[model samples]
Target chain A: MDLTTIVILALTGVLLLLSVIKDRRKTLAALRVAYKGFVRLLPSILAIILVVGLIIGFVPPKWIAQVIGKNSGALGVAIASLLGAVLFIPVIIAFPLARSMLDMGAGIMATAAFITTLTMVGFVFLPLEIKELGKRFAVARNALSFLAAVAIAVVIGVIIR
Target chain B: MNEKADAVANGKKRSMRERIRWDYTILFLLIPAFVALVVVFPDKGATARHVAWEYFKEMAMILPAVFIIMGLVSVWVEREFIVRFLGEGSGVKGVVLSFILGSIPMGPLYVAFPLAAVLLKKGAKVANIIIFLSAWACIKLPAELMEFQFLGWKFTLVRYLATLVVVVALSEVIGRVFFKQGYEVPDEALDGAEG
Candidate 1:
């Protein structure tokens, strides 16, 4: 297993063991909660998988690369961030996708913008966010996140490349 | 008829169940569509299936454990404890704690919404909650590891550092504008979100 998998598994193992040792009853309850939560997570996970398939099957990597490539400039970054906000691709898949785009010649700035907004500002989940966090907080957080993502992207582009 | 009002009266449980059902319908349709794609274009379908299968395997491995840890934390960390740490006058410790809590790699962003709502109701600073949500979205350790694997250490490290500064600044800026006196969370805010 890779470091990510190993570290995650180890962390879970240690924590679960501690919880079980500390209180068997609470541990059991926690297990039940975990199960239900996992179930809740399933639909989104499956949806992302479906999206991954579509992206791979239909969308050309080369086309994406051209749009967001090194010379694609500020327009590319804006487009990438907008697309990032619109889609709800989880980070698990987003990193791989970003890596692929980079390999296909996408600029560092564009990729950074894409990943930042992909994670931070999700318009696809805006309704749910608003439902839970309230209108003002949700809208402001999202709007601010888009700006923050761009700022972070620019910073990374300057420092790294 | 007031559809929105009717929805509130119907209660959140019904909507949550309906949403799950809706998700199932999509999954049901997508499976056949996926199969059809495989039939129509073998090469592309194989590539798509291959990629999907890889992520499915990855998520399956990590998610259960993540959920278990999240469950344990949620069950163990009392609301009062959260309020004490993140409530008014919490200061720098609260921000650091939020980042730590959020960086635990527990689950997806939507899963965080309910907890964020809970924090809001419990008198946590809205700005701190924003930091918590931003950290959950941006720099969870597992995600950072993945970024490192895919993008290398330089990109991962730079982005991680940059994201930290930006998230805190943005939250603070938005906090000043909207939560000058702190959040007054509405009743319906927690309707379906809180446990």
Candidate 2:
């Protein structure tokens, strides 16, 4: 396993041990919860993986670079931000997809914008957000996040590039 | 009274089951579509499958552990504990705590919504709750590690620092503009909201 995976596994192992020691019953309950959550999340996770595979397999790197490459400029950032907002890919898969995009010559700014908006603004969850947090809070947070995402992308583009 | 409560609980359970069924349906449909793509364009399909397999392997390595950690957090971290530290009058300390709490990898952002709502109902400051939600969404520790692995240190660090600052500032702005009169969370509004 890679260093990240190893670290995570080790951390989980140690924590599990400690938790079990502290309270075996609670630890068992935690494991059950974990199993249930994994089962629930499995389909979406698999779908996302397949989607990423398809993108890499079918979509030419040249085309991706053309759309979001260094020369794509402000328009590219906006497109990336919009895609990030609309798409529902989990953050774990998003990083790998983004890495592939960068390797294919996608611009740093565009990638950053995509990642930022992907996480911060969830179009699919908008109604739920509004229901829970109220329309005003939800609307303001999302709108501002979209704006902030673009701005952050521009700033990162300047600094890194 | 007991019968009414039981009916409401059963209704909630049914809806939850329905949602899971819909998710499975979408997954099943996508699988065939993917297989069809492979049939149509053998070479590209193979490549896609290969890439998908690589990602699947990577995710399989850590996702279970991540979920277990989440489950632990859910069971261990008391709602009252979250409220006591992040509630009203928490001030700067509350904001910092919120960010730290949020940065810990637990679950998906949707799972955080109800928790945020609970904090709101318990009188957590608007800015802090916003920061908590934003951090939970964008800057979780596991996500950052993945970002670092894929994007490298400079990119990861810059984006993390930049997002942190922006989220905090944005949260303050959102709080001021939307909750100028003190945020009032409606009781019972989050009844059907899934965590």
Measured by DockQ, the strongest candidate is 1
Q: Write the per-residue lDDT of candidate 2 for residues B174-193, one digit (tens) a residue.
A: 78887877676553333321
* Candidate 1, superposed: residue stretches over 4 Å from native: A86-111, A119-142, A154-161, B1-13, B100-124, B140-161, B176-195
Q: Summarize candidate 1's per-residue lDDT along B68-119 as a digit string, tens digits.
A: 7656766666767777899767889998999998897666676577567667
Native contact share for candidate 1: 0.74
- After best superposition, candidate 1 residue B105: deviation in angstroms? 6.7
Weakest 10 consecutive residues of candidate 2 chain B by summed lDDT: B186-195
TM-score list, all predictions: 0.72, 0.68
Query: Residue-pair clashes per candidate, as listed?
Result: 0, 0
After superposition, candidate 2 runs with Cα above 4 Å error: A69-74, A84-115, A118-144, A154-161, B98-161, B173-195
**Candidate 2 CAPRI-style tier:** acceptable
Once model 2 is optimally superposed onto the true structure by TM-score, how far is the C-alpha of residue B153 displaced, in angstroms? Answer: 10
**How high a TM-score does candidate 2 get?**
0.68
